[model samples]
Target: MATLLAGMGVVAVTNAEAAAGCKVVYSVPSQWQGGFTGNVAVTNLGDPVSGWRLTWAFPSGQTVTQAWNATVTTSGSQVTATNASYNANIATNGTVSFGFNGSWTGSNTAPTSFALNGVTCTGGTATTTTTTTTTPPPTDDAMAATAAMQPGWNLGNSLDATGSDETSWGNPRVTAALLDNIRAQGFNSIRIPVTWGQHQGPAPGYTIDPAYMARVKEVVDWALADGFYVMVNIHHDSWQWIANMPADRAGVLARYNAAWTQIATTFRDSSPKLVLESVNEPQFSNSSGAAQNAELLHELNTSFHGIVRRSGGANATRLLVLPTLHTSADQARIDELTTTLTALKDPRIIATVHFYGYWPFSVNVAGGTRFDAVAQKDLTDSFDRVHDSLVAKGIPVIIGEYGLLGFDRHTGTIQQGEKLKFFEFLGHYARAKKITTMLWDNGQHFGRTSFQWSDPELFAQIKSSWTTRSGTASSDQVFSARSSAITDKSLTLNLNGTSFLGLRHGTTDLVRGTDYTVTGDQLTITASAITRLSGSRAYGTNATLSARFSQGVPWRINLITHDTPVLQNATGTTSAFAIPTAFRGDQLATMEAKYADGSNAGPHNWTSYKEFDRAFAPNYTTNVTTLTSDFFAEVADGARVTLTFHYWSGAKVTYHVTRTGTSVTGTTS
Candidate 1:
């Protein structure tokens, strides 16, 4: 059974009893005048346990105010801390620790005893450790390793590009200088995705081309030499062959194992900084449901684990990353990966998932143009789930790729202000959740040839988010009507923990009271300032102002002066129909087209508001709105459809169009 030796201050439990024997270390790592931070480490010394709960009674009157890595609650002098979802299992000799901030009065004393799983802990010790210090985790500590690789970047559309070679995707060849530039840009790690199926031989061998392998090594070596934690993975091959695991299980598994065998052998002596990901966004085709998919992925992961660990050299202890089905952050996917990780029983394993934000908002479709509450909730919920499911349990998680899906078309698909807010908030929240996020570049963000960011402002916000929060506002644009008297415009500022200093225009500071004023979180620009800034009533952006803050990047505010945009009648063939238009400095937001009976008449018929750039696109330089063939193809022939063009300036214009077979006519009636 179990024996408790009260005089010896120890408890002896037998494995036959299935009771837990544990040791607790409680220390006050830091203390202020009336507050302190407490850290407790629970080490299970006997009988592996799952879902552990540790309880203790405080000797002094200390109240826990906040906690991390555990769910902690206090009742008077008694306190209890339970394992989080992801970290519920503590194998024999495994240690799980958590910390908290508490308020103390006059005196602070560590608890003399602690219990684990209702069994009194033996060898419990309490100390007021004056020095705030932490021992660096061992080399194979995946949690510490992944945490050190924070704020990573993806080398996208290059090696992973589905083509003949690395440069086939239009991005230039990888260069050492590029690695230098990335390091200079504040990225701590780089994920190099290599698509192997196209470069591999057929059948049993499935041998990857030696030259392609060498090239991949060159890039990985460069990153490692630059002191960057590098991750190399099989990218698009997931769809090329791995996804067909259900239909051709043996063949897929053979090829998959062969690929990893060669890869691990090649990088077997590489630096410990190099990490191997089993597969990128692992998936299954023709699977019954989540159960089969999970089983299929588990097989691949187990095989990968075996191949890499047996390859010897650094591969023996190398950090390995595994992805859930589709690398989605859904709870089921996370739990699936958790089971795989636990089955592998490897401490150097990390779970990876990709996030492109909420679908509708990510693509700027269905009028999800703004990063509103729904979108924000989606992001927070996903992160919270991942944090609780993986990170909190001592298992690290890496957001392999994160960005707006619409970024593929172009950044302009989403408004500048909304995009900034999304990135700013994403960076801040990811850091808060203790999860590392890697931006999915795909050559859209950083320019390869120029070695510069395509959008400096967006990059600035992203870079700043790596460290601290940046202030943002409700909207980045202050629209002023050119035909009417200028009125004061106000924007709600999101201080994000920093105080706004003031506003400036091209280096000249605006007078706080005369030109602008800040009351609480509302920043207002005076009417006189708007009138002056809108010099000559320009049709587009008349001026730009920078909102300075105590820290982080400055938020840009554009003063846009515009009147109601005008559209002229035009006629053209079905191949091309460009409505003559004068934007008058206003920007198109969305378009709506409907027939006489109010039925949607565009490509996306479910909603009257059509997808920007897909159905209808505005060409400010050409001064025309071109209705794409996609839109006309779906329109009823010989039926007149009324189109409503909405602009960012809050102005809407109505026009009518009739399609008669090959020809089309447009009118403002």
Candidate 2:
């Protein structure tokens, strides 16, 4: 589908329309002696495009050392870059972007001209086009407060660990010089996570030890004195038996109320720069699932909110953050917190979630050497969901604790290039969404005494993302393929796409506009295309229609009906297919597909039924690749078209080869 133009350096499909006014904004986020980070955004001002290729010539002797969101190739000073798979399809008036870290020898000058698909862009020079002003969110106090708290650094482990003594956690004692250095590096906020349970009294009215409380207050004073927004929270108390055990709920609630009451009362007189967080990663289990757990967490959050509200003085107006269950990134978990907190109608309240998303990269666990396309997609979709579900609704979100901790723990083993990629991508993505991001440092990478980071390259990338707002890289376009039955004349999809989710019989790519009138993700099939398919018997009741996710990660969900013999009577078939190895038994689908015969089956399928079927379960630690199922179809034959449906989670290459019978053929948008 990708071809180089005959007489031009452009690469695109020959039959595709050559779009005009393809503007590209180039920006040098940061530049040192011999290296600089560059961000480029390609905006399609004309018709939509299924794919794009950008070509430019670097004026100076700059050579790209690292690139992301697009594949880059440089021959001498000329650069030929193609969009990554996830960003290939760009909608009309929509934009896709990429970034790189490059090095120069003597002179470093920005490129003068740029071309996309052979057409000159409006803003191809070094100077970038100023887009519309990003109006701050409607002036809620909480939103305003969170808006200013961008790109933060957490004082982790020192205070939040088990011991009350900061040095007991292996981190040096807090210092004023450390705070000054942090502010110099572009961090406007400091999140000091403190474990109160370990330092508090036992039983009904658990009181925080005065000296221990003073220690926490001392750290808060240091940050506040330096004019940094300081967020102090009850951290890691859930590890104790009283906090997370169901049998200890009554005693736990009493301790929780007492601890927050004392902490809030102490900070009540402090400046508005001080934010109070209720807890850190509240833990508990329920047999009823996430919804049940959410219900229980709701009670806990309510207690935290009420206790903080009762505390007088500056605490009344100060921003208060309530965490999602376990600080989970799952939409359901977040929705629970958002819905519960929104009903309180507290304008000063904000939501918090941890972003150890894909622990292999974020945690020190084993994972891939590179932050590849799949990781990019996962990051995009996960945070974008937070924006759509919470931020847009007047609730600002804070990724309170996030970073590639795995890099710090496995320094020599993990690639420094991958660490840089993770920080840069995460920073840019957070900037685009205007979400507050904080790096979780536990005295591992960043040294408190020396004011130095073990990985200077990683720190530089984070600083660049924080400082460069005009031309920071944007997360790749992410679209989840949703299913709607094909109507008489039109097939309405979710959003717009650069290309049509193609419809084919077997191997032939259906002609656009002739077979279907396409606009974005929606495709309206004309009578001609329907007539042709009918004549060819390509799409009928007995035919199988499947569409692959063309952007971001690849996923295809098959909803198998319980009535099918595979679930009801057959023994050799499976219900779950292509489950990611990092999957900690998280249920991908809530509603199990019924058998083709209209009978219901048990919900648990893949994890229990098909383990032996997979030889190597793909996980982040081993290969950056996920172990995908070699077999696709869970149901053998006679699958009722109504029963089987496909859904996908954000995973890297979840499906490499699809299973289909003679009558099965579909499209990939």
Candidate 3:
């Protein structure tokens, strides 16, 4: 009979040396290669742990070449090992639980003695009081939970160079603790990615340096401790993935399996608190070779499912999200996708897509035309298309990227209130449609963890932005509130706590008092002409885009290509425009950004810079001179755009542009 030998202060039971490192338990009747395992329990009745090292010596040659949550290092049949980051930290009182798919070659007998961390717990001690194994997966209702945490946290910014720098641990935050500030300021998730090889040793290939992984684990652990869902993935590992495509068609699956064997094993046993994205925006734009690469990607993802299911720890059934060929929701509907879709033996597989409807506008990758009246509609149209398709397939969708830039020299500028309104509305739309959303946030610039999106002005406005459906019960109102976008149009767009309404050249089309239509993440304002500013002689041209979005994605404005750079002359700004030694004939200006996940989005070459470079003709605009910090010009005849750039934090340079279409030389500082 089992009895409790209770003691005061702490239980000093006999042979207490075998403290459980993992504390999860499970009872599953499954057969290993040699025998059957009906129940298992793993516990971490210890201290701070990055992971664990467990070794089960075997008399026969039954080796563990493949495993998850735990890594294996063998020498001459004497096996030794440990757990990956996810399982390593057997918190003082916390525990992990999981089962493995193993095989047996001969007779077996349960060991009578067990020792953990060099302390031995003799047989016949206390077995009934130990914790079990297994991490419970997230349920579909997860969307409702995060939505309820903090309502107006839908919009986000990508913290490029001026925003953040990479840390040794693959975290983009200038430091690792920023996530707490982000959470306190009201954000819910962080997407920290590592360009694996970029910061890791071993140049540009396999073998993820231990130091890099160690650093990454530290940051990820920090995020989880703060209670935010963390997304860690393999980012621009350069050609680590592209160069290592499966040579033999079948081997593709094998390699994919092996890669995950390492990844899952690394973090599999942690709490069921993080999301593991299979890959980032996989791309190969060069040629027909793109198709071959796409096929390989699908094969890799297919293999990812099995590997994830077999993590062999608490994360065995953890949430696993899969991206499309390039994570494009449109292409994700490819016919062959059905193969992987049907093959989804595990229920945790969530589909992912990147929502950058207004490309140059969202990322400003290339200097394109600034905001247009219909741009917002076009942006949401794409979200609707993807939303409808994913919903029809009965699966949750995730928008990986979306943002608006404040530094476009030609046509890039949106009201602060407008952006916040965009965020609130997007979340409403997504919630109305019952969709889960995660904002891809950069460290700062537009206010990430370091800066507050809901500051003095943005805070009251964000709360006021959401409209409650009157005359309904609390629960129903919340439900209806989620599906509908805020309709108030009189919403003033503020920036850095400054009013933007009176600053524009003309009266904006956005009404002073009217709510826009909201369905899912799509929003449309009923207005004649939303007036926005562009091209201040003191700064560059400013294009005010109407904002729109899909639930689960960042809300953003839209912009088209500009015919000419807004830079008019050179002599007006800091000095006549002269390319820095860093300039390489019209190359796009790019930056590095750190997201909420403690990861960085980088090396982006936006549009306006290149357009300003190749098209500026001095004589047509102002004294045709200087530009830096802000654009300048003489508005006599037709406007001529000129461009000048200044180095700021990193590769990101601030632009000063000036142009005069005719009689219009207002400066934008």
Highest TM-score model number:
1
C-alpha TM-scores of all predictions: 0.78, 0.51, 0.48
Give the poorly placed runs of model 1, Cα more than 4 Å off.
Answer: 1-138
| C-alpha RMSD between model 2 and the true structure | 15.5
Q: After best superposition, candidate 3 residue 212: deviation in angstroms?
A: 2.2
Candidate number achieving the greatest lDDT relative to the actual structure: 1
**Residue 327 error for model 2, in Å?**
0.9
In the range 496-526, model 2's lDDT, one tens digit per residue, is: 1223345443334456667656564455545
Tell me the TM-score of model 3.
0.48
Residue-level lDDT tens digits of model 3 in 1-669: 122221112221335444333332333232222432323344445444444554434445544433333555667655555554334445565444433323346742332233345433222222221111122224344333333223212222221111123533233343333554444433445666655433322322334556656766787777666555666665553145443553444433444455566678789777666778776766543434755766776767766666777767856657677777766656434344545666765555666666544555343334433333344565566567656665456656666554444323211233243344444445445545545555444433334433444243333333333322111000100000111232222222223222222111122333423424433322333332222222221222223333211111112232111222232222323224432222211113332222234332212222334223222322223223222222222211333332233211112333323333322232322
Candidate 3 weakest ten by summed lDDT: 471-480
Question: Order of candidates by TM-score, top first?
Answer: 1, 2, 3
Question: What is the alpha-carbon lDDT for the whole of candidate 1?
Answer: 0.85
* lDDT: the better of candidates 1 and 3: 1
Candidate 3: how many backbone clashes? 105
